[model samples]
Target: MSQTVSDFIVQRLHQWGVRHIFGYPGDGINGVFGAMNRAQGKEGEIGFVQARHEEMAAFMASAYAKFSGQLGVCIATSGPGASHLITGLYDALLDHQPVLAIVGQQARNALGGHYQQEIDLLSMFKDVAGAYVMQASSPAQVRHLIDRAVRIALARRAPTVIILPNDLQEEPYESPPRAHGTLHSGIGYSAPSIMPREADLDRAAEVLNAGKKVAMLVGAGALGATDEVIAVADRLSAGCAKALLGKAALPDDLPWVTGSIGLLGTEPSYNMMMECDTLLMVGSAFPYAEFLPKEGAARGVQIDIDAGMMSIRFPMEVGLVGDAAETLRALLPRLKPKSDGAWRQSIEADVATWWKTLDGRAHQPAAPVNPQLVAWELSPRLPDRAIITSDSGSCANWFARDLKMRRGMTASLSGGLASMGAAVPYALAAKYAHPDRPVIALVGDGAMQMNNMAELITAAKYWRSWRDPRFVVCVFNNEDLNQVTWEQRIINGDPKFEASQRIPDVSYSRFAELIGLRGIFVDTPQLLGSAWEQALASEMPVVLEVKTDPEVPPLPPHITLQQAKNFSLALLKGDPNESGMIKGAARQVLETILPGKQ
Candidate 1:
């Protein structure tokens, strides 16, 4: 029997080391599904994971690439199915994760006829998969399309696309003939060792050595260079701040390692950026120039694998384009040890004070439960080597500020896109990548209602297969779009328009119970600690829901005068929950000013 183009494509993907593909099935993609069915349970065959929606599937693929450091793959049908993948693919593209999307298209003859489910997928995918996007015109083209898509996605660390016409998928496979205009592509890609020139490294070292106070910012690109980052920081007696995506790049236990940097940043981080004489940015594209050092106030040096990303955030005295770990390793020997210990001591003191302030804030009383306390309680209880994920909302503010990450623990969310509805899917993919480790996802009510609830079924379907059955999704049931609501007050000077801010309160815990998963609900702060314990110990997947107060502000590290005025203006304009908002904000502010005072 002759192998169909779909069969050849599947086999070729496995050859290129694709272990799993996430997507929803459709008639347009039935040919590939048929091929997958035939290849199932065979030696070296690829596994397929069916997601509730194509969007979630793409999110899972993006996260799989992030957590596993492998080429992530997703598939969908033509038109809507293909279009549903755009947002998630953008998440991968912006975050610099390598993902490949394969979608089925209409029959060749029906493409221009405007048949059902026929849309111009090529133009739709052009931006997200701009690194490489192609359609297989003939059976012979399938081989190279698969090869190039996989190779380029890995090489460029971005998303790639392949559009397969249904009719061509069932046709007999053919290899490119050994003739002119025919190309033969092979499987496998190895990242080459990249290093900056010696002259560049020497210049960076000189700038660092001259400065009395040095500050470092690390991002997702620095994940693999943890030890190198530490060595450089120690040599220069510099303090380090982590971008949200690089939270796990350094352990929070380090005194000088300030937590997340930006609006969700720590006071110590903001202060370090404001006060430092020299700045070194490693592998981070943390946008928000306001959170960085003032223009021309500090000498800057940057290291990144992508030349385009170098020196974009802040003008630098030197920009080195190379792998983070490799470049840092080369720069380390050239750096002269700084004798000044005063700057390091000051940073450590500020970091210590910030943690204490956070503790006071987390312990402050709310209407029922303080949102910060939920994360604060979980911080000490998180098992060693656990993986954590969070959605974008007020929940993320706590996740960024309160969660104390230890060495060996991995965590990630939709970094670049900062999209909602990604936490559950990210957790699912984390479990697939490391089935033996426990995975937890922190979500808000808004994101849970948006699309995460449906993914709980996906969890129920696959939890028992995991070697470790401790997957917990902790939902913050605040009954409001708390993040954006605050943004309205602080950024827009508008009151919380109840019509848009209020969300229907649903029993996320009960929903989990209906699907054969454990459910625990906590309405009081005292129960928060034990609830986490119960959820983490459950053999089945669990949903831990906390009835948190939406009025509690996700306060910025350093609120600007304009933000203060805007917040006051919103209150003057008559917010619906004006009393609770005042109380919550006051309690949080007082905790910072008068620590431990009720």
Candidate 2:
């Protein structure tokens, strides 16, 4: 029997080292599904992970690339299935992750006939897969399309697409003939050793050495260069701050390593940025300019692999385009050690006080439970090498500020897209990538209701296959879209419009129990610690739900005068929960000024 085009495409992907493909099944791509079925149980055959929705599948693929540092692949049928993947692909594109999307298209006979499920996929995918997008017209074209899509996605660190017509997928495979207009492509790609010129490194070092106070900001690009970042910081006696996506790049145990920097940032980080005389940004594109040093107030140096991203956030005296670790290694020798230790001492003191303030606030009383306490207690109990993920909302604020990361642990969320419904999928992909380690996801009720609940079924389907059975999804049940509610008060000066902010309260724990997973519900403050213990020790996957007070403010590290006025204006306009809001905000504020007294 002749091998089909789908068979050859699968074989080609395997040669390029694709281990798994995440997506849902559809008739439009039935040929590929048949190919995957036939190839199963063979050596080095790719595995298929079935997701509840195409969107979640795409999110899983994006996250798999992020956690495993490999090329992630996702597949779907024609039309709606293809459209659903756009959000997840954009997540990978904005975060600069390498991913390839393979989708089915209408049969060749139906082209331009406006047949059912015959949308123009190329036009739809052009923006997200702008690096590369192609359709296979003949069996000979499938090989190069697969080869180039994988190569380009990896080389450019962005998503690429290849559309296969249903009729073509079933046709007999053919290789391109050795003639003009025919091309042959091969497998394999390796990142080049990139480092800045010696002259550039010398200039960056000079800028650092001349300043008495130096500050460093690290992002996801610095994840692999942890040791190098530490060495540079020690030599310059600088305090290092991490962007949200780079939380695990430096351990919070280090005295001078301030926590997340930005709206969900730390006090020490805000102070360091405001006071430093020189700044060094490594592999981070943290978008907020207000959180950085004032213009012309500090000399700047930046290092990034992408030349386009270099020096865009802040004006730099020197911009070095290279891999983070290699560039920092080259720059280390030229840096002269700072003899005066005063600046380092001050930064350390501030970091220490900030932690104390956080502890005091966590211990303050709430209507039922303080959300900050949930994260703070989990910080000390997290197992070594555990992987954590969080959804975007008020819970992320706590995840950023309270959870102290240790060395050897990994964590990530929807960094660039900041999309909801990604936490559960991210955790699922993380578990598949590293089955030996435990994975936890911190999600808010809003995101849980959005689409994460259905993903719990995906977890139930695959948990037994994992070597370690400890996968916990902790849900903050606050009954409100707390982040946007607070944003209304602080950013828009509008009251909490109850209709939009309030969400229906569902028993997330009970739903877990119905699906054969352990469920633990906590409403009292005293039960929070033990609930986590019970869930982590369970033999099966668990959902730990905590009833938290929505009125508790997710206060920024530093509040501006305008923000203060806006908050006051919202209160004057009669917010629905005005009394509880006042009390929660006061208790948190008082804890900072009068520690342990609240």
Taken over the whole model, the C-alpha lDDT of each candidate is 0.94, 0.94
Clashes of each: 0, 0
What would the TM-scores of all predictions be? 0.99, 0.99
Model 2: per-residue Cα lDDT over 1-598, one tens digit each: 7899998888889999998999998978888988898889986488999999999999999999999999999999999999999999999998999999999999999989999999999999999999999988999888889999999999999999999999999999999999999989889999889899999999999999999999999999999999999999999999999998999999999999988999999999999999999999999989999999999999999999999998889999999999999999999999999999999999999999999999999999998999999999899999899999999999999999999999999999999899988999999999888999999999999999999999999999999999999999999999999999999999999999999999999999999999988899999999999999998888899999999999899999898999999999999999999999999999998898899987
Tell me which residue pairs clash in candidate 1: none
- Regions of candidate 2 where Cα sits further than 4 Å from its true position: none
Per-residue alpha-carbon lDDT of candidate 1 for residues 1-598, written as tens digits (9 for 90 to 100):
8899999988998888888999998988889989889899886588888899999999999999999999999999988999999999999999999999999999998989979999999999999999999988998778888989998999999999999999999999989999998889888899998888899999999999999999999999999999999999999999999999999999999999988999888999999999999999999999999999999999999999999898889999999999999999899989889987999999999999999999999999887999999999999999999999999988999999999999999999999899999999999999989999999999999999999999999999988899999999999998999999999999999999999999998999999999989899999899899999998999999999999999899999998999999999999999899999999989988888899987
- In terms of lDDT, the poorest run of 10 residues in model 2 is 37-46
Candidate 2 achieves a global lDDT of 0.94
What is candidate 1's CA lDDT for residue 187?
86
